[model samples]
Target: MKVLRNLIAIGLVFLVILSSGCSIKSTNENVPSSSNLTVKMLDVGQGDAFLIKTSQQVILLDTGDIDARDLLVNKLKAEGITKIDKLIITHPHADHLGGAMGVLMNFDVKSVYDNGQITTTSTYRKYIKKVTDSKIPYKQLLAGEHLEFGDGIKFIVYSPTKRMIDTEEDLNNNSIVGKLKYGDFSILFTGDSESAIEKELLNKYKDELKSTILKSPHHGSKTSSNNAYLKAISPECVLISVGAGNDYKHPHETTLNKYKKLNFKIYRTDFDGTVTITSDGHGYNVLKEKVQ
Candidate 1:
């Protein structure tokens, strides 16, 4: 009788271990998978545009200057992107949304994301008209909405809150701020947002402002990239989009000095041509195209 009892106890222990192993395997299967999200900061002179390619989607943040349309099209073609999953205008600034009309005409876009806030530029008006004619789905993204691309890639809109939108400030202060996350990596894209906007976002999302990369706000203009904001973001690398010999003297010396003091690696499109960052869902690589 004793031998029989011991055999039953051993069998029960074995069953419990087997069930625990199965539970662990099931948990692993439910975890989200890693994704390869590639971000390309195209050199379109003194303008801003960023192409984000994920495992399941392709997104264009802005389109640079109107004249840069051809360059943008060629680059998209080279990437074999015949369609764009989403196009975010960020704002109605001429330099940011000017080439968007060309892109809308060239590609089959699933949707267009913008604040729908008008600006004084004719280019902005024309782009808005094109979107209206296309009848494509349009949505005004606001802060707190989290956008998810395939795999584990996600973007959180963190700026242009209701109060900021109502404030009669310069459009730059109202520019949309987007934070992208792919696994352990995060990137903050500030679209021409000035010191005031930056301060607001910093205060709102102080804990989440930590990012691995930063798209230097307003092309690294002195008016943006405030010291407090910079200290909060603490990006490991900074990318500045500006044109060589720009009349405005973009990427101001003061801003450059701030970045230098922080010891963050910097990549300037005007000097490096095109900058590309690719991630394996764990680590990222920064590649620069030599300016010809």
Candidate 2:
């Protein structure tokens, strides 16, 4: 009887050890991997530039103002980036595409996407000349178009529809409005887009316009972020890219108050310098580099 009892006790101990080992192995397997999506809102001062990095590709959105050419190039180099897999110029405005020439000269750009809007400014002409000379594949960003950068990471264009009317209002309205989606995470980029376009997008996309983050339209200008538009696409976080002491008084007080009233978390390049948000397709973390 005693020998039988000892055998039973030993078996129970072995079972417990095996169960623990299995539990540990399962826990190790369940651990999450590192974040694969990183979006950096560069501080180009009164201009716009964003660097998006996925597991397999790098994308650049806009290219700061002319004065920021060297800084923008150096910033790209510091990240050890020698090539841009996809470059999207949201509009033809100087603050948005002024550094296009500098970027083309420095990096090997695989493809370029633009809203197909034309401007007669010197900077716009120079940009076109450089793009033509580079022989890079260029395409117009159209509504309903989809671009996939990696597994489960994609961009959906939602503005500048086929029937766009080329009027003065079309310049800002034609600004490429798109959303980057990865799993449950989504970010909306509205390049200088304002009320007219915002209203149209709200009508077209409705609930589909929801996002986790919003790059505030027109640098948080009062002309954008209308009350009706804000409520339609309620983003958890808002990023404003503007320069300190800018002439336009970007991120107007009323705009800030509206976001504040909505209880949305806001980060600004003017205040935070460079703002970066990284996500693992599930959730994201925001980090800022303070300007000295």
Candidate 3:
């Protein structure tokens, strides 16, 4: 009996150590919403930015590119967003986090969340300094975690697992991938994560990955949106945040063909100034600035 107890104690300790790497944390306070949830894929030339508005909070997903901070700020101001409740920077890539300083400089940010990746770029340095100097509450997001999105909507984070972030040098794959869940309506936000991470998510989440919509991975780049992974998510609609006449030629043809084959409704910020989706928990309606 003594031997069995010793072995059980050791196994329990091992399990605790294994699970401590990444955790699923939830806040005790939840402010349930009485209105619809809104997500806008703002058009920021040559980069990406998404604004999510719950009834009680406003969340900025990405900050576009370094050169396009004005456009990002102007667009937000045009939308009457004076303050941001949460700023979630997916990765430290130039295009994704370049305008982070602009956001920090222009708005009242309540808190910040990121994947805990680091880069030596000046833009990153400036952005981090601003966050630190401002004394904003900052937290690192990892797989298996949850963030409250206000009014019962929550973000179920699924990527940049501590193991992967430590082992994988690719910042794109380390991008934070999360699914915004609001009742029956949900959309997966892929922060430029590539095929390998998508496959990992497939194996981990499986059927749970199915979402009503997918914020097309990697801005519709061919390097992402793996066929098997797409089949697993089975998104009815795909939203791509790419810039017009981009040198990188994003929203590649191969990805479009795949979406077509699957008959998923497609919307792109390049064609549509800003694509917004409003969900009332049970259903959703998409509204865009213009038609292509």
Candidate 4:
């Protein structure tokens, strides 16, 4: 009887240890592997181009305009960036896909991601060809997809779902929107999506739309920054990527007024030059080339 009781006690102890070990393994898999990250929104004239750097890899969000290709290449080289681990293009528009060729030619890009919208333009055709010819891994990002931006960073895609892409009938409305989250800090990258899509996001995300920073939609076009959308996001600051004297006259006064009403800080590439942000998962700081 004594021997049987001893065996039963040992078995219970072993079972508890086994269960605890399994739980720990699963928890570790979900935890971020790193803690430091940097995002640089370049001052590419009249366009968008952001560089994300982590200890494990570098990500290029957009490539700016066709005419700005050389300058973009020069800037990357100056920063000692010879390789890009991931190149995420929001859509096939000229300003977004134009510098793709230059990037592919000058840097070793390992993978590419875009909205998968084909267009009838030489620029789009050539850009696709370059991506294919170089044998880089290519994929289309749809809503709900998650990307691991190494160093404890995660990017949650919120727009350009396959359903939206097939039905929107407009490229701008299908622009890739995503939230880059590191610890408690997050930045909402809006691409060039305008009003209609903004409404969809506002309805779907609701309170989840809030972030620490917002990359102003469509360069702060009056077509976007709707009251409901702005209220949903409620970012502490907003950044606009536009040329100093752009023909489009982006960042319309109406949009500025909306940001002001919300008491959100505004920064523009035209006036502030490059905007760089660094984070340590728990907190972050925003730095600009100029006061604006």
Winning candidate number (lDDT) = 3
Task: Compose the digit string of candidate 1's lDDT tens values, residues 1-292.
Answer: 9999999999999999986654211101112343388898998898998999987999999899888888888888888989999999888887888789889989999899886576667887787778888898888888888788887888899988766666655778778898999877889999999988887888889889999899999999999998889999998899999989898899999999999999888899887888888776667777777633
Give model 3's TM-score versus the native structure.
0.87
lDDT of 1: 0.84
Q: Which stretches of candidate 3 lie over 4 Å from their true place?
A: 1-35
Q: Work out the TM-score per prediction.
A: 0.86, 0.87, 0.87, 0.87
After superposition, candidate 1 runs with Cα above 4 Å error: 1-35
Reference-based TM-score, model 1? 0.86
Pairs clashing within candidate 3: 32-151, 33-151
What overall lDDT goes with each candidate model? 0.84, 0.87, 0.88, 0.87
RMSD to the hidden true structure, all candidates: 13.4, 10.2, 19.4, 14.9
Candidate 2 residue pairs that clash? none
* Comparing 3 and 4 on lDDT, the stronger one: 3
Per-residue accuracy of model 2 over 39-117 as CA lDDT, tens digit each: 9999889999999999899999999999998989999999899999999999888898988889999999999999887
Candidate 3 per-residue lDDT over residues 205-268, each given as its tens digit:
9988999899998888999999999999998889998888888889999999999999888888
Model 1 pairs in collision: none
User: How many backbone clashes does every candidate have?
Assistant: 0, 0, 2, 0
